[model samples]
Target: MIAVPASAAGDGRPAEERGAAGRPSLWNIANVLTMMRLLLVPVFVLLMFADGGYDPAWRSLAWAAFAIAMITDLFDGELARRRDIVTDFGKIADPIADKAIMGAALLSLSLLGDLPWWVTVVILARELGITALRFWVLRHGVIPASRGGKLKTLTQGIAVGMYILVLTGPLATMRWWLMAAAVVLTVGTGLDYIRQAVVLRRAGLSAAEAERDRER
Candidate 1:
């Protein structure tokens, strides 16, 4: 009888098989949902600007598209983690889609004079800066989304949806309040992520030093 390799006999499977088992497929339900969100961005913009952003019916349609896109964001991450279908593409593309949708909405509103340009500028600046920082430290480690980050996203979505509805009087005032909260959370979470990056960098340096010592 032919003898099995000792390593294979102990684990009953080759290393490649184990690695393949843990690797996620690129074309999964979660990634599909993410792609759907990205596709809806242009649709949202078209609907918003179809009637110069003044028509009530077009605004309603725009809001519907934006709401659906936000819902996809909520589910895509959950589905990826639960189904074990998380991939590098999903991690990178998911946040990009989120930023694109929000940026489009904010910029469109500012252009239409529905929202202040300052607000748009501040929020977009924070988002793009943090995105760049994430990639900068990618070699050292990843900064996962914190609880505050999720809350910021939720608040931003609610505030933008409210603005898209173009509410009047009391509801309009409420929208401003919601936006204020979102801005606070956005800035606060951004600072937290910067701190996390510093910690991760230090940890990576420590790991490298320990490895070098062991080698010596």
Candidate 2:
């Protein structure tokens, strides 16, 4: 019997990498954008807390930094896919950079007393927990991000951006509703991810057992 390479056998490498002969460089635009987002996390935090943590001008600066980071995130993955430059570095760092920027924003807002501590804790817990779950089941299979997950991320970004800005009367109330929607999406999508991971792990284990039986 001929042996297949692990990559070709889909032993946890991304589908795109299977049967591919060439590797992309780590210095591609996608990775650069991800790194930029990671760097902006600290800048956003500093600007968020500047001037007693409530100055409109400083908040605006922080919001600009955040907006830029989000924009880069939107572009980076598409660029990587279209250009066939999806490096392993990009796959790992992109998600970390995303969580870092959003985590910093949520935590900073809570510390400043702008957002409720519970909101921050819940969002952060979901984000971190999902990430850890991905790694936990990584050897089994890669869970592709669902459309609902993308929607959840979009809602989170917009809601968090609204909270970052100083608003008045009706706008403030609207932001609250938006944030409520974000929380709902966060929890809902997190549960969905967990379900997918469990299914993937079970399928992978069953497949491995079948292969062992065949070998014996």
- The C-alpha stretches of model 2 lying farther than 4 A from their native spots are 1-23
What are the lDDT scores of the predictions, listed in order? Answer: 0.88, 0.89
Report per-prediction Cα RMSD to one decimal: 5.5, 7.0
Candidate 2 global TM-score: 0.88
TM-score computed on alpha carbons, candidate 1? 0.85
lDDT: which candidate is best?
Answer: 2
Which residue pairs show collisions in model 1?
none
User: Per-residue lDDT tens digits of candidate 2, residues 34-66?
Assistant: 899999999999999998999999999999999
Q: How many steric overlaps are in each model, in order?
A: 0, 0
Poorest 10 consecutive residues of model 1 by lDDT? 12-21
Backbone clashes in model 2, listed as residue pairs: none
lDDT of 1 by residue, 1-216 (tens): 999765546443224323343455677778888999999999999999996788889999999999999999999999878765678889989999999999999999999999999999989999999999888888888899899998999999999999998689999999999999999998999999999988998998999999999999
